[model samples]
Target: MSDFQSPLEAFLYWEANSPNQVFLKQPVNGKMETYTFAEAGNESRKIAKALQAFNLPERSHIALLSKNCAHWMMADIAIMMAGYVSIPIYPTLNQDSIQQILEHSDSKAIIIGKLDNYATQKSGVKDIHKICVGMYNENDGELWEDIIKSTQPLETITLPSQDQLHTIIYTSGTTGTPKGVMHTVGNFIRSASIMKQVMGLPHGSRFFSYLPLAHVAERMGIATHGFVIGAEFSFPESLDSFASDLENCQPHIFFAVPRIWTKFQEKILEKMPKKKLSFLLTVPVLNILIKKKLKQKLGLKEAKFIVSGAAPLSINLIYWYKKIGIEILQGYGMTEDCIISHFNLPNDNKIGTVGKKLSTVETKLSADGEILIKNNCLMTGYYKSPEITASVFTEAGYLKTGDIGEYDHDGYLTITGRVKDQFKTDKGKYISPSPIELNLSKNNNIEQICIVGTGIPQPIALITLSELGKAKAKDLLIQSLSASVKEVNSQLQKHEKIEKVIIMKEEWNVDNGLTTPTLKVKRNSIEKIHQPLYKSWFKMEDKVIFE
Candidate 1:
């Protein structure tokens, strides 16, 4: 396995060793459809032959548009085993965004999953081959099954160099357009292996993957290491079914973004109040009892790790989970770096810090405090945009993370803010909105909150309340939310405190341009659209409580 030339090669070797092991599962028609490594490998071979039948040059680009389904993994390895590059798009993308990515990547063919919104996408884009999941609508392009059946299994194909591009992950540009970040196989495999070493991802590690696989986080968190290590991966049929799915999988290893972690905390605390539960744990004997109760509630009694990343996590939430015997660690990474840069090690947990640089990567902080990352995990460059790529790296060799980070005496790294998200209050105090926002939104009822007021006396919290919690927590909502925000406000300087709160009635979604498909807020745009009204809304009161 160590001698394998690339990640895909290692995966192929694992498949040969344990062909009958259950490698992947997908929900079809609300029922689980399973696949063994051998079955999946054979299906991928069919797909490779199908791709080769196009008569295109070797390593032709193929795009995968789907949610976290077993087929998405199948299509990816198929592309790799066939010596083609895979460009994946989130299944939630709008038709226009999908077209832009497919067109931008010059994908020769697009494999799509069954999504209601994308039913019309087959004929919408130009110059790209289209195939649908499950069945053929005559108006839609060819059925996915039909294409695989048309070709015999590929016998031989030369794999690309380790440094060759494997995927182009497109991310939102600060300017509202998107840029494709290109990564090579070495970058991906090495990053994935770092997680394996940091966490105890020995063979047969159990993992449940529900995040949008198009994100680099999932690409490395599940698809990359999960593939090479032959982990048991279970997919949630849909977001609504995620809890049921998690209960069923009860994976030993858990990795989730801050938003999802927040949701998990929210869901748990909704049934059991965190503060009351914490008070009950004041006694040593009761603490263990409460911890057991919490574990049973989370269905994670056996889960060894619950790591949070893809954004800043609130320290209060981390400490709260710790009180219940759950170790919630933070990770720091970006698409440009193939998703892993820093991880809070198990024995080395610091509440506010993201963690130390992975053993496989080296990091340095510039005099100005910008993080400089250099690793095999660093991407080749932004696809077709050398100017931007060149700007992100040092001529001497380091990827400028654009994150303002600092290291404690213990070597753990804490991210203060994005260099881009730093804002100055009218009082001239510089404030980073992310940490404050994370602290304030610990209330399970507030789904998302963006801190605005770059040029004002203090920040204002524009909150998108969690509709899921509305019906159940109706009477207790306001007091609960105010208490949570106040607790977070205690940690902030007087100038950095939120002067007011605005609870939004509507959800800020990707389709609305408020959030990226990955759920990170488009802060600049949100501020631009809402900042002007701050004086009228915030200055009039200290707290705008929704009655």
Candidate 2:
């Protein structure tokens, strides 16, 4: 049970100690293909040798575009094993974003994993080393299958040091163009070590990898940290079969984003409507029965812990899952910090806060109230973007997190809103919009809520109701939002309150660039989209005017 020193060290160690242990499982053509510890390390080393023989360039960056698959993980490990930095992008990103990230990162090669249209995306990029997996037929560049045949001998496995650069993860780019966050081997080791201790993740603990592998959530939550702790990773075929995969894998640890958590919540509420679930309260026996039934449906019967991250989670969402016997804990972190900042300790649980900061992780509020973090996991700098990196960190070395938060007396941190989101009214009261918006948007009827009142008298909500909250059932959504508003507004000061509410129609998504990939509202972008509507609505005094 000695420390492995680095991710690459962990890889070699696991291969030697547990060569037959299944390290990675990929669902290929609806069948499972498990890669043993020896196989994962052996395949990755071969890819690294192939990359070296190709002789791309020195300190070159390799970009990987794919979902969470074994090949993607192996390819990523290849980049590191070959002494190259890995720049992984979301598979959901469009062509322009794909081009921007590659060009910006100055990537020399691109590895394509299982996707519907690999050739289509490969054709668009003008100048870059392109290779595709599962493409046995002849291609200009080496196929992943053929490349792994030339594995570098275990004795020849060369990788960067604990302090050397390991990976560069791009921000979701919700605000603008994505920024490459640089992380080193030391960062990965420290963050993973802290997580292993905190979560008590065991060696060879099985995990299901379904989140976007390119993002920090999957990078740390599954690939980097999960593997470092000797956890086995399994890939889902696709989102459509995520449930079936979960049931089959029966992982000890589960990590999911907020949207998936909400969907899981919706599944529970759908079968046992809130009213019916509430009706069980009269009988304690019925409550226990409901918990067992919900747990069985979510395929979390074997989960040691269900962790939610990558976005802010509403308290109501946690409470809903709590009723169904899911111990959903919220974690707060970012790409720059390797996806761990705070998490609820295993023995103690809190709903709103993301829980205690990791041991030896330094966190404090700035003069403007932004969460500042200083830890071993802080990035070296933005890849080739020193200016931006310098700007993100202060003279004290703590990252200027751009998020506004407060610490409860017990040391748990509750995020209040974004630093830039605190808008001033004409009357001089500063409004925190997200808190109010989250309060109202908690209802199943309200799918999204964006609060805007920039350069105006007071705050106003621009909400988009769920499909079920449409014209026919408008009263239901309105009832939920109105009651929520009244409850939240009651706690705020007069000038800090929302003056009125306006319902919106169009859905705002990160794909459309209206929201970040993590689902945080791009308020600046939303302002542009709703400018004309805001002007028209400003002239009127009515609330809830029919569109």
**Please, what is the TM-score per model?**
0.91, 0.93
Distance from true location, Cα of 486 in model 2, Å? 2.8
Model-by-model lDDT, in order?
0.78, 0.77
Encode model 1's per-residue lDDT on 1-547: one tens digit a residue. 5645567886787788989989887765578889898888888888777777677776778998877878888888888987888888877777788888888888898777646466555444567666666631233466768766775777785666888888899875444678888888877777777767677667777788877888888888778878767787888887677787787787887787667767777677677676787688898889888788777666577788777887787777788778779898888888888867887777877888988887767889998899999877788888888898899999768999888989988899988778888888788888888788877766767788888776678888888777555665655666677677788788888988877778776678777778887778888778878777877775575475441
**Over all chains combined, what TM-score does candidate 1 have?**
0.91
User: What does candidate 2's lDDT look like per residue over 1-547, in tens digits?
Assistant: 6886787777777878889999898887688888998888788878777777768777688888876788887888778778888888887677777888889888888887766454555544558777778632325466777766655443465656777777788888546667888888888887777777777878988888877777777777777777687788888887788888888888887888766776676666666677877888557898787777666667778788788876677788888777667888888888887766888754777998888888778999998889999888888888778888889998989988888999989999988888777777666778888777777667666667777776667677887665546633666555666777777779888876666678765777856788776666678888877766765676687656444
For candidate 2, the TM-score is: 0.93
What's the CA error at residue 369 for candidate 1, in Å?
Answer: 1.3
